[model samples]
Target: MGRIPCCEKDNVKRGQWTPEEDNKLSSYIAQHGTRNWRLIPKHAGLQRCGKSCRLRWTNYLRPDLKHGQFSDSEEHTIVKLHSVVGNRWSLIAAQLPGRTDNDVKNHWNTKLKKKLSGMGIDPVTHKPFSHLMAEIATTLAPPQVAHLAEAALGCFKDEMLHLLTKKRVNFQFQQSNVAPVNTTHDEKDDTVEIIKLNLSRAIQEPDMLPSSKPWDFTGATSANFAGACNAFPGSITGFQYGPSSFGNEGAKSPWSQSMCTGSTCTAGEQQGRLQEKLEDENGGESEGGKEIRNGSSIFNTDCVLWDLPSDDLMNPIV
Candidate 1:
């Protein structure tokens, strides 16, 4: 069904509330107070619908409404609020006294947008153009395996560009004490050289990539690798992201999730035995374990973590 209109009567007045009309609406509300907006028009004797009357009061005729230019502090508040809430105008307006959502929306459309753009920031994303593009590139980059024999690597385009650009920017800084670039050298050629140099280096020395995360892979992980407790490889236990993602917390032993326990068995047999063991240990809550019967999580969780170096590494190209 179509949405019901707030008002349907043709005789109801529309647009341009005159002083007498405003006076009548205000006087009635002052005495009885705003409760049911639908009944306000009838009680107040106004020629407008309840919805129109509500807007007329809240957006314009509110007693506490503040007029005049938005102060610098207020403008900063709007920008900060906007960065967090996006386009929730009513929320932004509530933070500043005497401002309506309409007022805040108009000011942002007319003024704040231009101001942010002039400062080289994206008014929507609130990031510098270079940084935004780098993030976009990374998310969009297709997963590529470095080699069938290597552990798969997850790449960030942001890191690659950051490394490339940092070299160009710091070449002549005072702290660096490096000699200035010869004016005759083309900047374009230098950038191309850096890209080519690092593109190959990324494959061989992925750890050198800034902010690299170890467990990120390029494609859909095989079902064999998928944990019963969690789909992500970061948590072999399958309960959470795990104690430490980087392995910097020191390695835990017998880490591979292989079900084989010295007694030789088929892969299928091993899996069945593992699942039965887990169900018995966890009292039948394996997929997101309930109780760790053996005083360790996740082992009440059975999963597979492949032994490495047979992993391929990949980073974004763009």
Candidate 2:
């Protein structure tokens, strides 16, 4: 068996359609509706193929066709419909009056696809590109494990901050004694020594006591604390605070440790450990004593304590 040709290539005119051909196609379609596209060209006196005649009439010469630029509403409709139907140009064109399937397909390929891609949306899937990438990443790796690890880190940070704030540990301070100027007059001179103390301490709690709830860093907006959470670690049994060095008084704070029972520990346990550590470390030191607990006994003289405001500590600086 032999295949039949759609049209005779030798006799059919190709390339751009002439004005006469356009007029023929328009007039024939106007007089008689397009029932059979294979017979349209022959009946309309067009030397082009039936397919060519149908395309010319539907895309260009149709009286109901929208000739000018597509309106914003029309463009939006095309995008929405394309998202739902996905490359079914004929179905999309049916909804858009006067728009041919060929025109819609061309617009989608040339402009709409690029626009959607620029907006971080996948034109084919109609989903956010970032979301798609996240799904792919999760599929490749175990997201649960990653989440658990991040939660553990966040819990550790929150625990540390809670302990530091609850204990009311006296931070290290620099003391300077300035002597008053001497007077050479006949009258007696009373000289007073001024002591300057630069103290650093974390913001105190509302009632000057630790809160029952754990300090939450999850609400923080800063990049440093973006993924921080209040989730307690299941593996950690307890926390121990030990003296890193010896004090000049020879009387040092006792080692304090708080044990976590079962799977988790509360913020109170952390605070208890901190309180015990601070008491043992600075219990013997007097108010005017030269030594202070700087969270650790290391560098007894030059320890520096960094203080954070209450609001700033809770909600980190972005």
Candidate 3:
């Protein structure tokens, strides 16, 4: 027969702590501080277990524990971090200053984990769910894992191609929208209510700029700026893509409407050029606007018209 279970019938103290017990434990910790939880009950003159005392101090009474709503940045950081670290909340907490392991754990389980899963990211592996799962089965799974692995592999293969194709299409669309921009000058003689028709037009069209495809990092993370605390070997590095691969688009993303929902390049280029000329007259200086005007910026002296409303748009002299 198996040996008798330890403490099965032992009269061990358990359950909630009393007010008197709290007072005693609090006073003892405040004076002596807890060195060993197993000896805490004996030293503090309480019947409660050492584990109970430790939990009470760490979870409830710890002075540094911040019990409040997490800020937006904090929430974002937590979601990003969880994507890399998996469910190791204690390790995750170590990186987040003023955050408790229990709080971080609850936030992940109740909010971030579910949100990422909804966005097609596997909370456990922190990648396109299919990609992460397939990689896992490939590395550690047995021969029997084939049947179970096929679905994930097929899904990721299709999605990867689809996303890549979509990005290419977006880039093509943006390139096709480039147009010629021009500015017109007018001379006025306000004293006699007369206008001269001798005007000059200068074309300011920006060179054809390359497109930067967008990344599909819809998944929430645990940490935003910092690296993951528990990043393991072969962990899906930096969310979906490698860290070195991230590049910011110049103002407009390739997939955004500004790139995709436009006419052919020649037509768009003309309209964009015309728009830039008008915007320049009205003092517009966005990078896209600058591109349309063939000028680097609206404030650039190369194309700025000294007359008309252009001066009103420039910053006043100090």
Q: How many steric overlaps does candidate 1 have?
A: 9
lDDT of each: 0.46, 0.42, 0.41
Which scores greater on TM-score, model 2 or model 3?
2
How does candidate 2 score on lDDT? 0.42
Worst 10 residues of 2 by lDDT: 192-201
Better of 1 and 3 by lDDT: 1
Index of the highest-TM-score prediction: 1
Better of 1 and 2 by lDDT: 1
Clashes of 3: 21
Q: Comparing candidate 2 with candidate 3, which one achieves the higher lDDT?
A: 2
TM-score, per-candidate, Cα-based: 0.44, 0.43, 0.40
Model 2 lDDT per residue over 44-154, tens place: 888898888878877888887776765444455566545444676766565456778788998889876755443334567654332233333334345453453344334
Candidates in order: C-alpha RMSD to true structure: 19.5, 31.6, 26.4
The global Cα lDDT (0 to 1) of model 3 is: 0.41
Candidate 1 local lDDT, 1-318, one digit each (tens): 985555658969998999998998999999888898877888888878989999999888878898898765456556655654567787667556678889999999988775544332456765332233333334333333223112211122233233224433222222222234332336434433332333333333333322442223223432222221011112222111111321123334121212112322224443444334433533554457543345443222323311112111011111
Alpha carbon lDDT of residue 70, candidate 2? 57
Candidate 1, pairs of clashing residues: 150-310, 150-311, 150-312, 151-311, 151-312, 152-312, 153-313, 155-315, 298-301
RMSD (Cα, Å) of model 2: 31.6
